[model samples]
Target chain A: MHTAGDVRVEDRDDPEIIEPTDAVIRLTATCVCGSDLWPYRGIEPADHTLMGHEYVGVVEEVGSEVRTVKAGDFVVGSFVISDNTCEICRSGYQSGCVHRAFVAGTIGTQAEKARIPYADGTLVATPGQPDEDLIPSLLAASDVLGTGWYGAVAAEAGPGKTVAVVGDGAVGLMAVLAAKQLGAERIIAMSRHPERQKLARYYGATDIIEERGDAGVAKIKELTGGLGAHSVVEAVGTRESTMQAIGATRPGGHMGFVGVNYDVHIPGFELFLAGIHMEGGPAPVRRFLPELIQLIWDRKIDPGKVFDLELPLEQAAEAYKAMDERRAIKALLRP
Target chain B: MHTAGDVRVEDRDDPEIIEPTDAVIRLTATCVCGSDLWPYRGIEPADHTLMGHEYVGVVEEVGSEVRTVKAGDFVVGSFVISDNTCEICRSGYQSGCVHRAFVAGTIGTQAEKARIPYADGTLVATPGQPDEDLIPSLLAASDVLGTGWYGAVAAEAGPGKTVAVVGDGAVGLMAVLAAKQLGAERIIAMSRHPERQKLARYYGATDIIEERGDAGVAKIKELTGGLGAHSVVEAVGTRESTMQAIGATRPGGHMGFVGVNYDVHIPGFELFLAGIHMEGGPAPVRRFLPELIQLIWDRKIDPGKVFDLELPLEQAAEAYKAMDERRAIKALLRP
Candidate 1:
């Protein structure tokens, strides 16, 4: 992003193995993320910023210390880089790893190649070269699929649970799939977009709530016999969306918030009175990578369906515009 | 409490069973709570309001439908009344019960006689009351002990975890005891008071930090290998205390905030970055009543040591003043 709203695709030096623990991969697929819009819409600063984080590729080169992936191996990497050996990473919070770094704005993956540090920890190789048709799903596993899976797991969505998702974005849609896969008894998708609503249903959303805010909370309670959902996932970081998610959760319920929060402020008194379990923040995508890759490889989940618009790497600007204008749930970029 | 800093003891009609499930109890013991200070200090409204929510007493009378406790039975009751049969109550959130009522503002237990509704759900009868030495311990179970236990449970404090208590008051001290009983490997108490520090240690706090706010958080991190505590209990209902508790918790750790929040606003960005599990509210004391009563009866835990000042019901004003001035950790009243 040269400047807010002016994303120009420019030629730059390719990423290289700068560290002994690093591995450079030739990009096969990359995509725009909901968070990318923060800088695009000028909500956050952007000046000559590297654009993408999500990526899937075949390893082209590995530093001497890299052992997990080798040249010619197809691999998927998390948006956040982690050593995965630190105490935090061992506790399944790889995003908060002591030696963690954001892949965005540093080693932008929306290019021919990118360098991934901590190769043994951040990158997970597929069983073998993935079939051509499975590329998109594998790419989805790089971030969205893993993030949504984390959100579901954090919300404790399982058998006998009524899970309510509080966004219509790609991440929210992915959470629906995760909840379904996790065996939730009911999945309520809060969305007004017809296309997203359709995808939500395809992902196993048992109910659709077009209403939002207080009305949305009331609807959830009405649907859940006046008790609200047992688990709620907040995939939108806005104040309204966050509060709505909290309000839609029953007492003693759990809420998993995965949206990148900006200026939201939660009133402690209301939260206390709501009496719900809340866990959120940056999703530790690396924690669920192995399992998500297996699920996608097994053809059990099609998270790539969230990408409604596909464009070549050169058309990255258009992909940003499409997502910013809400014309696409997510836009996949092919290099 | 009649206006701020004014507590008066006056004669009034003795409480009578008003509901079929109601039971009238002759108070044996009651106490001043930290929350009571909110009204006493005029932070919350209080005009000729009844006080005292914590109590242990003998059942004096029971309505036709009351079955759990009969007249002459010694019992401990929660600060919140619940029908117990409601879904919320059955789910162990009796404090958020569909038919819940506060025991503080109405049916003040500090009086000689008080009416308790939903007796079957709210009151736990002791095993043949006789030991006067165990009265105070049993009374603590009415609220503080149970609230602290719930806080510990909410924080998931158990073996191999380091638990931190963010207050030195009765509830905070009880949380220390609860964490110890739950098998937390380490318990850190944040307090500057020598007396409270001693009590915290006696209750099993393995470490003490006199620093507060950011300093206290830094000290906690220093003690836990720069990672902060695994489980944190916030028993002080202030913005600084709340943030301190959140800050003193490691990423992916759990924070149980049992403090009755008043104007606290939690920044979403900070909390999201903290990446921790947080659960709190009015504790479901009724849920832990049976076990706590059993513990007290068996002399396994002496939670009553929290009451450092004792007074007769006639000196309720002095008790409130002592607590307001921080001259007493807790004030126990013999009604």
Candidate 2:
């Protein structure tokens, strides 16, 4: 990753065990994340920063202190690297651990090899190596799937609840999947694009609203008998998306937003009078990794359908472009 | 209430039961609220709007559908009138009931006689008509104390939590009391006023932060060993207060705010990145009125100390002016 709109497939020195708890991994699969496009679009500063925080990899080497996994073990990881034992981590917020680190901004994962710090806490050893067919789904669990899962959890989605999702990005579609898995009685997906709307239904969206802004909010209200959804997932960080999500939630409802906010501004007058609960940030995906991995391994859930394009690691730029242009919902790169 | 910066206590037609669920109450005591100052400060349009919502009163007359209280019943009421039987009311958010109404901007309680809509849901029958001394405390429950209680509850204050209260006004001070009552292990009050600071400590504040803005946040972080408080109550609605509350709370922590927001803009980037749980708005005071009234009747809590000045109802204008000028923490009016 270089300046805005510039990405290159260049060779670099291979990663090796750097920290006492670090584990070097040989990449098996990685995918472009919706958040990565922020820097790629110049919405954020990239300027040659290490990019990509999602990966499914095979452990190639382990530091002396690494005990959770050994070489040859395939692992699923979260975007945030945490020690997993801090008070914050213990309380299920590994994303805000005392010693947390962002792998995307520090050590890029879209490479042949990457180093995972706090390996035991950040990476989950899969039940042996996964089947090739299941690897993509497992990779999805590393970030997008985990983030979507956290969004549902934060929104308190569960049985008998009506969950509404804003945005049609990969995370939003996966949130539909998560809300379904969480037993939401009904899930509403707000999207206009035909393919994304279809995926939303496949992921268990009971209804899809094609309108945007206030019209979309009115649609949600119309569906919920004018009371609004009980739980709303905001997967878009724009001002309109945030407001729409808040507006679509019932007065005493909960909203969980996981979008990487860029220029969004939420007026306190609206937020205060909205009379809803909200919790969001970089999701503590690590906190939900074990359960998500087990579900994937047991064939209880399939979340990797998001990968609409597949390419070799050498074709990473094209993969990024495909996702950027919305030609593909998501692109999976195999090394 | 007249226009901004003006209030009157002129004679008006006596309120009679106007709705099936209405009850005419002869207020025993009424008080001005921090929020009343919003319109008083010209931030809100208050022309010809009924003013006060906090009161303790005797039921002078009850409509046929008013079954909860009788003509002689003494009641403690919430600021927001709700129908109690609505799905939202049944869900413990009477303030958000489909038929909810604000006592202010519709019908004022500062008058000698006022009509309360949705009597069963809006008013809690006190164990019995109380002594004069308990009137002020009971009046506090109508809004300030209840709002504070809801703030504490929304912030999830509980055992082992370090709770912080922002602002030193009546609501903020009551939040200290609420946090203490909710079993928060540590309560920090952020205030610069010496008298309010003393009251805060007396009300169970374990720490007092006299600094404002970032310095206050630094003090809180320093006090919490750099992890920030587990719960924060924002009683000031300005941008600084909101940010301070957000900053004082640890990631994964909860914050409840009840300030009447004025010109406050929250950048979504900061809110999303804060990684904290937040619930605010017009507090569901009706939900907690019964318990609070019981506590007040039992003499277990003394929220009435907030009333630093007491005067006759004829001095309503003076009372409003005193509170607006910060000459009094709160003012009690006798009809």
Candidate 3:
């Protein structure tokens, strides 16, 4: 990212194995994220910042300590790089691991090649080289898919639960898929976008409510026997969406929020009065990589469908614009 | 409370059965609560408002529809009145029951006689009339002990977990006891008060840190190998205390806040980044009454020690003053 709304595909030296635990991978696919819009729209500062954290690639070189994957191995890595052996990682919060680093600004997965630190701990190699058709799905596993799954799991979505997902972006759609796979009996997708709503249903949303904010909360209550959903997923980090998600969850229910929070301030008294369980943050994608990869490999989930637009790496600017203008749920960039 | 700082025991007609589900109880014991200070301190509006919500008493009369407990039965009731049969109640969130009412503002338990609605669902009868020595303990079960237990449970304190209690008040002390009973491996009590710190140790706190806010959080992290406690209980409702509790919890850990939040506001970005589970509200004390009453009856837990001051009902003003001035952890009033 050169400046606000200025994305350039610039030439740079290929990433190399700089650390004993690092591995360099030739990119197969990478994509723009909703959070990227923060810098693209100038909400967050950008000065030639390396963008894109989601990636699926083939190992090109590995440091002596990178034992998990070898050259020619295809892998999916977490958006947040983590030493999976850390206490936090062992406790299933690799995103907050003692040795953690973000893959976005540092690695710029959208390039031809990138170095992944703590490669053994951050990358999970597929059982074998995946078919071409599975590339996008594998790329989605790098971030959005894993994040949505974490949201659903955090919300405790399961059989007999009524899951309500707030936000109709790629992550929200992925959460709908996760809720379905988690066996939630009912899934309600909150969205005003027709395309996203249609995709939500395909991903197993049993109901759709276009209303938002206070009205959104009321509609959820109206649908859930006046008790609200048993599990709510907040995929938009804005204050209104966060509150709506909380209000839509029944007292004693759970809410999992995964959107990158910007400036949302929650009134403690209101949250206390809501009497709900809440958990959120950057998703521990590394924790779910193995399962997510296997699911995609088996064609049990087609998360790749979330990528409605695809472009070559040279057209990265157009991809960012498409996502920012809501013209695409997500955009895949082939190097 | 009659205006801020003015509490008087005034003469009034004894409460009668106003609802078919009503039961009149002759109070055995009642006590002042921290929340009462809100109105007493003029932070919240007050105008001759009836106070007190914790009580242990003998059933004096039962209306036509009242079941469960008849006249002459000794019982303990939750601070929140709930129709335990409601879906919310059935889901273990009795405080959010469809027909729930706050016992504080409506029917003041700190009286000679009081009418309780939803007798069958709100009050739990003891196995038998308790010995005179058990009165205070039974009264504690009405709110403090129950609320603390809920906090511990909500924080998921259990065998393998290191629990931290933020706040040196009665509820915080009770949470120490709860955490112990729940088998937490370690318990850290954050307090600057010597008396409360000693009480916390007695309640099974393994360590005491005479620090608060950021320093307290740092001490907790230092004690837990720089990972923070696995479970945290927030018994103080202030913004500083809430943030301290959240900060003291490890990534993927749990925090249960039972403090009656006043004007606290939590930054969403911070909470999200913390990657912890949070659950709180007016505790669903009714859900744990059976187990708590049994624990008290079996002499397994003596929660009555939280009350350091005792006075007659006519001395309610002095009791309130003692609590407001921090002269007493809690004050028990004999009606």
Candidate 4:
């Protein structure tokens, strides 16, 4: 699956259990993430990076220590594997684990099979076997969807809170969906696209503001009694989005950001004077995987709608191009 | 007394009770603040600006609605003139009141008399007349000391937490003192001066890290199992100090900053990646004045000891010169 560009996908030997805590998963579905766009854009340090972190699959083999799921079980795993007992993971932040390692490093889901370390702690088992209908959504629960949900959680979105989502990308759109699930009374989607606006409203955005900068701030304030939104989820990684997130929040509100910030600068005085609580980074997908997987199994929500284009694993190049060209909200690669 | 410099002491009409809610205070002692130094140095707006905001004084008269203190009562007040009954003020953040006003807009404390508005809400009185010896320490509680104390509170400094303080100014020094009184298990003072180091120790600093940036981060990590402090107080308004405070904290930790941000730039990516909770702005000195006054009256702490020099109001220029020249940490002017 090598493209005319960099990063050739070559055939590799099937993954084996490297540790008693590891399990081997036969990939069924994996998708390209907006964060994955970082490397292709020349922002993230790509090098020989395997280039994918979201996946849903069937367990092919399990080591003795893997008790939560057995062979033939359907599952989804987080991007960064961690031992759940560590202080970092125990505190519900698995991405910052002391022994943290990204899935791309060893046998990523973009391939035929992958080895999941700390399998019991990092992977969530679906109820029995997941139907083909739920596969894509469960795969999304592995990273993007869960991350958007975590962003809403970090922003403290809930009833009576007005939430402003600062990006129209997949994650940002999903954040609107998450805020709605969290019972946000009013959701403002900051986007100009007709398609995104439609999706935003369908996902529970009560209002839409396409303005940028001071005008965008003014629009949000006009809709919020001039106090700004109670919560802001920033899903675009840039100085402007960061400032917009801060400026869109009220005096004692919160800003949750999960954008893969690649060289963004903020003015110190503005942040200091804004007085907003900020908390975000790589999302703790593992922390939400179990619940998300359960929700998907129960058919409670359909977050998989974010993937607008689907391609075979061999056509990964076309998938990336579709997303890179902005022709797709998100692209899926079926392995 | 107008000097050859920016600092001037002019004999103005004695402040009288103008509003039914106002009170007149005869200055017992008034001191310069680090923030006040900003205007004196022309870094902030100062032309026609009345000089001080911190003072411990004898109440000369009280308006009809003033019930908290009476004539001849020794009292301390916050820089914010807020009606305590407002929703914002009742939330313990008087500085953010809907109708908030600052002492700087009217008559300041570097005078023989000062007019205090919202007297019942802004002023806190001692049980009885204060001893002359307690005046200096009590006066410090008016702003610098209270601001620093609020910095610690905002940082959530309490039992079993390791706290780091960024800045060695009078406010920072008092923050070190505040953290100690708040029961922080470990206090790391980020200072390089021998004098400040000694004062920090006296204020209960358990350790000192003189290095800065990555090296300082490494030092803090080495001291806390490579996890950073649980709480950090930022009292310097520069970009470096703000970053240091954020960097010096562990994931899920908190940073409380009070330094009036000058020209500082913050990188949004780094802050987002750090995942620390931050909330700060002008300190609500009115909320803490009562307890601080009691502490002063009981002689448990000596925050006013931060003022290293004293001068008659006639020598206001020399006082400013001394502070601007770094010859004095803080200067007290006898009106």
* Per-candidate DockQ vs. reference: 0.84, 0.83, 0.84, 0.52
In order, candidate lDDTs are 0.93, 0.90, 0.93, 0.84
DockQ category of candidate 3: high
Give iRMSD, candidate 4.
2.0
Which 10 residues in a row give candidate 4 chain B its minimum summed lDDT? B1-10
Give the proportion of true interface contacts each model preserves, from 0 to 1. 0.82, 0.82, 0.85, 0.52
Lowest summed lDDT window (length 10), candidate 1 chain A:
A8-17
lDDT of 4 by residue, B1-335 (tens): 12123676676887778899999999888887777767766666666778778877889999998888999998888887778786557757677665577786476788888999888988888888877777778888988889899889989999999999999889999999999999999999998889989999999999998998778888998999987888899998877788888899887678888998867777767876776777777788988988988888889999977888999988877888888787888899898
Writing each residue's lDDT as its tens digit, candidate 3 over B1-335 gives: 78999999998789999889999999999999999998898888899898899998999999998879999999999999998998899999998888889999888887988899999999999999899888989999899999999999999999999999998899999999999999999998888889998899999999999888898888998999999999999998999999999999999999999998788889888998899999999999999999999998999999999999999999999999999999999999999
For residues A1-335, write the lDDT of model 4, one tens digit per residue: 23223545677787899899999998899988887777777776666767788888889999988888889988889988877777767878787776678786454677778889988888888878777888778888888888889889989999988999999998998899899999999999999989889999998999999998788888998998776888999998877788888899876678898887778877767776675667788888888887887788888888888888988888887887788888998988887
The collision pairs in model 4 are none
Interface root mean square deviation of every model, in Å?
A: 0.7, 0.9, 0.7, 2.0
Candidate 2 at residue B115, lDDT? Answer: 92
Residue B178, model 2: lDDT of 96
Which run of 10 residues does model 4 chain A get worst, by summed lDDT? A1-10
Q: iRMS for model 2? A: 0.9
Instruction: Assess candidate 1 and give its lDDT.
Output: 0.93
Ranking by DockQ: 3, 1, 2, 4
